[model samples]
Target: MDNTANPAFDVTKRLRATSPKSVAIHEEAARVMAAEIVGTVEIACPVYIESASGSRLTDVDGKEYIDLTMGFGPHVLGHRPASVEKALAEQITRGWHWGIHNPLQHRLGELLLEAAPCGEQVVFCNTGTEATMYAIRAARAFTGKSVVAVFDGSYHGVHDYALLVAERSSDRRNPAPRRRGAGIPSEILETVAMLPYNDEAAFDIIRENRDRLAAVLVEPVQSSNPRTDIGPWLRELAKVCREAGVLLIVDEVITGFRLAYGGGQEYFDVDADLATYGKALGGGLPIGAVAGRTDVMSVFNTGSERARPIFSGGTFSGNPLTMAAGIAALTEMRDTPDLYPRLNGLGDRLAEAINRHARQHKMPVTMMNAGSMFHLRFAEGQIRSSRDITSRYVKAEHVFYQHLQECGVLVPGIHLAFVSAAHSEADIDAVAAAVTASLDTLRNDGMI
Candidate 1:
């Protein structure tokens, strides 16, 4: 286990030695910032990015890296896309925010409704968190029900009601809901139900809870468990929701605009009663939206005769800058017939390369992808759900990423990565090589 003898390990050591600026800044940030970093996993080497272009990022130390994070799923066209940048520049000249109604929202709403299969009306919000929060409220208002059901291993957002997670000790087939973090009221758990993902038992649970459930919120592809073969499961879930009279809210925060121009609903051909979108919706800016059937969306109408119309609005809900960027991005996507196919093909190629290497070399890892979205699982065998992730090679996984960083590639601490239209065949080749080398390094160190 003499790591210094390995070339990959030596490269990582050199990288660490050269990144004194990032280390110094991280120390300073740790003292002032509440969290050392924004993500769940701690990066092996801290890197403070100074700027980003197409498929690459330059750190404060002027070290370049092939960026696979892609702004955590927003940059479908890659960083600072010219069209979005131009739209943003134009909007800035006209005024970025007005705190009042603007005409730009009209075209954006029309585009969203046209693309979303279930959309007849649309509402805007600031982030995916707010979008899901409002979608739940709208479902409750329309159905006169109090409880909402969410699948285990799915992330809705950061709100208190959206923070429920399945207890680890609970049955995989019949998960018990628990709060994810502190300060969430115990009462919040009463209104949320957690069901197992990609399981038939969820149908029976939905049927049993039909009377109390207002909606069943799900990510068409769970971020924690990214699998492409769940189309039938999603379609069945939609059917069950309809039969049970529960509104189906597809949380497309990560998949929207990235999976397809119309997002998960269009990609999977599953109709949702309400769909929450964010991430790629604003091109590269911050935005979120809820689109659904007119009946369910009518809960937002202030003029409605309903006793209490749902209140959902933000000061920057449909600001001009975001709307302009969204229009440009969506228009570009719509005009470019081959964009989705190309991006998805790249994702498939990358996944195939990585998985093929792992299988041939007997590495304890696999890569799963749904269209352009990808996640690296550090365990072998079928991973149908998050519960299946039980790899004992924790040290190996960490070291593999560290080696990848040394090879000039950057994957986010969370292992959920993405490929964009900006990434070329050469970028994919580089990533594949990095992954192969990282695995070899882990083996050399006897970590795997």
Candidate 2:
């Protein structure tokens, strides 16, 4: 390949521009920042990216790499997608904030309602955290219940209610919902319950608290689950909720928009009382929303007299720029025929290559996927829940992703990888080659 020409497919040129700055900022961040940044983030040896475009990120050191992280799974359309970028630029010309509601949020929310599984109402928010927060509130308001149930190992943002962690206390991993990162109040956590994922006993767990249970929230697929087809499990859980007369709030923040235009609810062929979406919905910006049946949302519309359980307020919740970008992104996705299947196919190819390579090397590993969101579990056995995500899957080989980073590909860790609209056939192949080479290095060094 000639160096003079810019490969539309590769972002090497952009990557080359930010290498120095990436290192410098990180070094300085460690010197001045808190311990958490150093222990978990900086020590991970990640590059500080300067710029990004479809399927690529340029680090401060001026190195370009294929980004599998997608900024922690937001850029489903991939970085700086032309449609999203153009919409933002156009919004800037009009004005950044309209102060009163802009049509952007409404338009974006409309798309969500249309695409959602038979839902016609929506409440826009600014982030996934808020989406879950308000969705819980809505469920509580509608059902007159105080407690909510979430799955262990499934992330519903860092909200106090969702901070519950399951630990192996004795025979089974029991949930210990600690004020883990701090600042969360004990009173707030009272309303949340954590349960095992993919386990059939979820109903039994919820049955004890059925009277207080407002909703059952779960991710259709565990982003960190070592296996797939979690949709079926979620559908079963939804049935359990319905049988008990409790609301089902499908937390689709990570699984949404990416799995399909309508989100995991539609893809799974299930109906939810409420659902949340973010990350991919923004196209590449900050955007989130709660969508579901009209009865559940009536609480929000009943006025302050009702004192609706879901109280939401934010200055930029429905800002013009985000809405415009969201609209454009949704429009582009909608117009394209079978865009989601294309993404799923892309992930299928990459997953196949990785698994096949592992088999050939006689390496004990497993790969799982949901549309474009994919993960590689180092364990070869059946992974039914968070307990199944063993150290072998995330310990040493997880760190070995750094080598894959150096090989010019980006994935969050050994745990999760994302394929976006911008990811090309060549990009997938290159990432597969990087994974193979990276694992080879680990094997040769006895690092695996």
Index of the highest-TM-score prediction? 1
lDDT of 2 by residue, 1-448 (tens): 7655422212333333335566567678778867533132422454776899889888767778898988788787888989889888988999987659876667788888888884678888889999998988888877888988887777888778877666556234335554556788878768887776777767687766789899988887777773456667777888888888888888788877778877777788877888888887887778778888877787777464566445677888888888888888888988988788899999999889988998889876666777688877777666676676566545446545666666888766334779888999999999889988877766765655
Tens-digit lDDT track of model 1 for 1-448: 9876765466557777989998788788878988864663365568889999999999999999999999889999998889999998988998999999999998999998888888899999989999999999999999999999998888988999899888889999999999988999999988999999999999999999999999999998899987778899999999999999999999998988888888888889998999999988888888999999988888999997777898888889999999999999888888899999999999999999999998988987889899788988888688878887885877667777777887889999888899898999999999999989888877776777
Q: Going through the candidates in order, what is the number of backbone clashes in each?
A: 0, 18
Cα displacement (Å) at residue 217, model 2: 0.6
Model 1, residue pairs in steric clash: none
lDDT score, candidate 2: 0.76
Model 2 Cα shift for residue 237 (angstroms) = 1.4
- lDDT of each prediction vs. the true structure? 0.89, 0.76
TM-score of each: 0.96, 0.90
Please tell me which predicted candidate would have the highest lDDT against the true structure: 1
Off by over 4 Å in 1: 1-13
